[model samples]
Target chain A: MENVATGEAQRAAELPMDNDAFAGFYERSARPLRAYLARVSGDAALADDLMQESYVRFLCAARSWDGEVAGRRYLFRIATNLLKDHWRRARSPSIEEIPEELFATSPDAARIESQFLLGPALAAMRPRDRQLLWLAYAEGYSHREIADVTGLASASIRLLLFRARRKIARLLREPEAEGRQGRAR
Target chain B: MIPKSCPRQSEVAAQVLRGQWPAGCVEDLRQHVNGCRACGELVLVMLAFQSARAQAVSGPAPVSAGVLWWRAQLRRRNAAVERIARPILGAQIFALVVTIAIAAILLVAQARNVPRWFSWLTQPGQSPGLHFEDLWSSALAMPVWGLMLLVFGLAAVAVLGGFVLFSDRPRQ
Candidate 1:
């Protein structure tokens, strides 16, 4: 067999050609990917499964990487495609319908209550909206970058975000909207 | 000094908490929230919301054993292909080289065995079996033919062994 080092190095040097430099990339990117998947799917277990599958696909495609910016873009591009495929193959569950038991029980009731409140509010939002929120808030992608990743109009990103936030805020503030709980008096 | 160019404290706090604002905007945002109690409280609530959301959405731990098993299976399959490919390539090259050498040796042997020493001195009525036909047929019956077959058979067996050893077993 040809040397794994030779194959990997050849692939790594192509564009974002530093395959050797992926340990840091993995650590930084994994959580963001997981978080993105979880929010979009509204199912932590499904998100975990997809995250692992996405990484396996990434490893398979590592030999074909072009360079740094392009490589990172490709990684996200693959992830987005996988997510789209998942949505296409499987019927998306209503985030509003995600079970209460999915949230962790914190010793602090306030923490648990806030989580319970936020989980389905996030779920009721569109998948693309969920992705936009997580990428902007958690992954720190700018509007233009999020635009590039999602293939949405760049100028529309700011507008879409404004709409998403306002909707989320309203959803969070109103328990009747979620149907699972009552607002405090 | 807080810039007049910035948005209202509450709006900017909302933007920052939503991660819509640029990272460079955080310093200006902090300055505004420091003096404004309402903005400070809103930012605290937003931060708390973020923390809770993060905690709630975190996925389960990875299955290390399953990942390891997958990697092991991939490596084994690759190793088996490599073992088989190397020797098959080597044997093909070796056979070509050996075939060329043997053909050259036989040509030289025929050239030297052509009665080069005695041909000039012999009468025209010499033994009929001394012709090229007799010499060519005798060379074909030599032990080298058997040796060549043995080499080829061994190479085939080695490749077959590699295939048998490396082929994946169907998991139950």
Candidate 2:
């Protein structure tokens, strides 16, 4: 541990963001990023893990962003990619229906289970639908920004967002009234 | 489904996200949200998600920024070193292979002369100068291709090793 820290200290001169600068960025972005991850992934523990990895990867990226907004977008991009990789590796295709039992083990897990009121309402929806809705409405991302963060085609974001909003509105309109909407076009 | 988006939807949603809907919002825009389906749904979705976000962020405080910063710095440095080491590792293996090939070729070339060289040393009444001459000839008897190949191989290994070790392409 001592040797690792000492070696890191020696190479610290070459790093882009110093402790204070990274701390500022981390403070400004961490909560929102975690919120986005948790809601999309339906897992608090994975959200925390992915959030840290996203920051580390953002720090490691070779290009410099134009400003703080760009940095935040890039951070989201990293988080999204990490989440995609996690999903692929875990082989759980229906992430929206992430089992309640999965979170029964911890306090944060329990909080996540209780916090997302709309989660179970639209829990059967596709992962992409949850991601698009969160990025669009919750994050206030324009269609273009949502496309950028989620790696969807920009031209398709409007239609996708519309479909996602329709699903959420119909589902949230009444818990008992779900799946009665005549097959949506 | 409306093919075109309602511009007022953005205004209403933005206001709601800022938690100033209806109060900070003008009466005219508030009425527009009530009438427009897009804007109405946008308000409901945004409000629910806004409350959900509050609950989510309030669940648990993440790790401290200082810890994140320190760990990121360490991981980034380690990744950079790993990136640079990959090509160097390849070059080192290439050098080792070439060195072994040279040793094998040399062993083959010197095998025929080994007994003569050993007997020349064991022979009595011969001057040390004749022994030196035989050894020199034995060295010269190695094939020209073998000699040139060894020199070329060593130079290639040196060049590749130097390039891979010195080039500093950072990991993304």
Question: Cα-based RMSD of the predictions, in order?
Answer: 12.1, 6.6
lDDT of 2 at A78: 94
Q: How high is each candidate's interface RMSD, in Å?
A: 8.7, 4.4
The CAPRI quality class of candidate 1 comes to: incorrect
Residue lDDT tens for model 2, B1-172: 6555797776787799789986999999988888988888788888888877776666666888777667766676676556545666786677777767776876786688677656646775563326678657756876788778768767766766665554443333
What is model 1's native contact fraction?
Answer: 0.04
Show model 2 residue runs off by greater than 4 Å.
Answer: A1-13, A92-116, A122-124, A179-185, B1-4, B86-91, B94-112, B120-172
Query: What is the lDDT for A183 in model 1?
Result: 33
lDDT per residue for candidate 2 within A32-149, as digits (tens), equals 8998887777676788899988887787676665678888888998998998899778877555466534422245554545445587654545667778888776777888998899
- Residue B22 shift from truth in candidate 2, angstroms: 1.2
- What is the CA-based DockQ of model 1? 0.07
Second chain TM-score for model 1: 0.31
True contacts kept of each: 0.04, 0.51
- The candidate scoring highest on lDDT is 2
lDDT of each: 0.58, 0.73
| Per-residue lDDT of B96 in model 2 | 70
